[model samples]
Target: MNAKELHDKTPDQLREELSNLKKESFNLRFQQATGQLENPAQIKIARRAAARVKTVLNQKAAAAAATE
Candidate 1:
């Protein structure tokens, strides 16, 4: 997911996306721990996606606060 796409979503949608990303990250870690993971790169990808979502959320919050 790109930051531009995330920026288009409302905060509520972004939160849900973040939740899903975190869950995926957890599952990826579990798979890696079990030696069942085909690609360890997935773990890093999920983490970065979650961070992107978080960054967008923070930017939205800051923009809202600035306007108030």
Candidate 2:
């Protein structure tokens, strides 16, 4: 997903997306181990996507905390 899309998601949704991305990453790794992965680049993509979600989530949390 793109940054714009990620930023648009609410905190709860972002967390859910993060969970799904991590699971996908794990599955990709398993596929790689078994030599069944059609695309090795998927691992990197999933990792970066997860990181983007996390970065945005943190940003939102900090912004909320700062207002208080």
Candidate 3:
């Protein structure tokens, strides 16, 4: 959801969330292709959510590397 929320989650949880988002995105694309999509905006939302999770994950990795 938000950066603060994502930052509070463990890496494993973040990965799970990212995986779910990707699945949702794929489903949305399929629906769109078949002209059955209810909301086209959902595709964009899912993409941005995935990107946010990725950004937080990268930040955590970078911080861990710095500490090491």
Candidate 2 per-residue lDDT, tens place, 1-68, comes to 89899888899999999999999999999999999999889999999999999999999999999999
After the best TM-score superposition of candidate 1, give how far the Cα of residue 26 lies from its true spot, in angstroms: 0.4
lDDT of 1 by residue, 15-66 (tens): 9999999999999999999999999999999999999999999999999999
Colliding residue pairs in candidate 3: none
- Full ranking by lDDT: 3, 1, 2
Candidate 2, pairs of clashing residues: none
lDDT of 3 by residue, 31-59 (tens): 99999999999999999999999999999
Lowest lDDT 10-residue stretch of candidate 2: 1-10
Candidate 1, residue 9: how far the Cα is off, in Å: 0.3
RMSD each, Å: 0.4, 0.6, 0.4
- Model 3 residue runs over 4 Å out of place are none
What candidate 1 gets wrong by more than 4 Å, as runs, is none
Error of 2 at 52 (Å): 0.3
